[model samples]
Target: MLIEHLTMEEFAAGLERTRTVLVPFGSTEEHGSHLPLDTDTMQAIDVGRALARQRPIFIAPPVHYGVCRSTFDHPGTLSISTETLKALTIDIVAALYRQGLRYFILLSGHAGGTHMATLTDAGEVLLQRYPELRIAVVSEYQLAAESGRELIETAGDSHAGEIETSRIMHARPELVKGTAPAEYPAFPKGLLVRDKRRFWPGGVWGDPGKASAEKGARIEALVVRELRTLVEQLEAWQDS
Candidate 1:
């Protein structure tokens, strides 16, 4: 069930049955020229809803705008500062912890550096503060890596690549463009450059030509399976 959709009394009643909550984290950024700006958010929500169906977990409203410093060069990309994202995550989880929800599963769809690091750090602090709290940060791609590589045609690039585009196709097909050009920028030949200006001139990192709804469905299925297993394990831990 979604916490945002429930009334105060209803939410409280549901919490009495299950302390586990799933929080979907994503970013609003340019997903190449094919996928929609909300592709990450849509995928996260779809996975969260699927996980909720298999277990009695409350689905918190998604943090749609996250830290995407790498993609800030792209137009229409809305990224928060790293510090802001960290503070927001800490505060939100702390609030839920006070409400007796000790188990938190953070579902991150965006793979940007700052967002992933902030999530891991904040989750670690929360777990340390509340020993009983089982806080886990799950990257859907990591969970579906093997399947994604085998199923997706373009698997190497990180941003707006086949995996992401396919996932978006499955989650929101209408938002995907039919004829979008794909480009794979050559890796830097010289020493690594720290400046965004030197690298990633087009605000994208991967080739999106091989994206398909079939691959997306396969990836989504794998993620759902892995997440369900984790949720079952958490339930067993709670019982023990």
Candidate 2:
């Protein structure tokens, strides 16, 4: 259930009984021209809610800002430093840890390289400090990318591509405008860091033209199935 929905007493009781919490790590960033800026936050919350339905887990309020240094060239993108994101994540998780929540499943909808690394570093530090804590940083994009490799029609998805657009279409169709054909820009070899707009001039890395509600539904189903399996494994680990 959503933690905000619970009273103080109910929240305390839930912590006493349930050992796990789902945190949605989202971002307020540019999602091309068609999608909304809060796409990442919306998708992450959707996944968190779905997971909450399958088991007894408290859904925490989502983190709306993320590390988006690459997308700085975009007008609507708001990004935090990697250090800031890492520290924020650690602090939030630490607060929950103090509340006796042992398991934290961070559902990240934004998949920036630096963002993921910061989160990974934060998870490692948290684990080091609290040996009993079990933290899992799961990315919705990564899950879909790995599992839907064959299913996604786009060659590669950098921002508001088919995978993202399709998911948004399925979840919130009103947010999507008409899509257009897109092409990938050639990147400098071994370029460590650069503005995303250089490669994605239109703020889209994948072919949004191929996206459809049916495809989005199929992708969500697959992701939810995989996440369910992960939850089951976590439950078994807790029992053991």
lDDT tens digits, residue span 169-221, model 1 = 78788888853556566646755546654456655556667777888898998
Q: Quick one: best TM-score, which candidate? A: 2
- TM-score, per-candidate, Cα-based: 0.89, 0.92
Tell me how many clashing residue pairs each candidate has: 0, 0
lDDT of each: 0.78, 0.84
> Relative to the unseen true structure, what is the Cα RMSD of model 1?
2.6
Q: Model 2 residue 118 lDDT? A: 90
Write out the backbone clash pairs for model 1.
Answer: none
Model 2: per-residue lDDT, tens digit, 1-240? 788798888989897768888888989998888999999999888877886777788899999999986676788989999889988999999998887888888889998888988999999999889978887888889878877777786777757888999999999999998785675767677785556566767777788888888888888878877876776676566522
Best by lDDT: 2
Clashing residue pairs found in predicted model 2: none
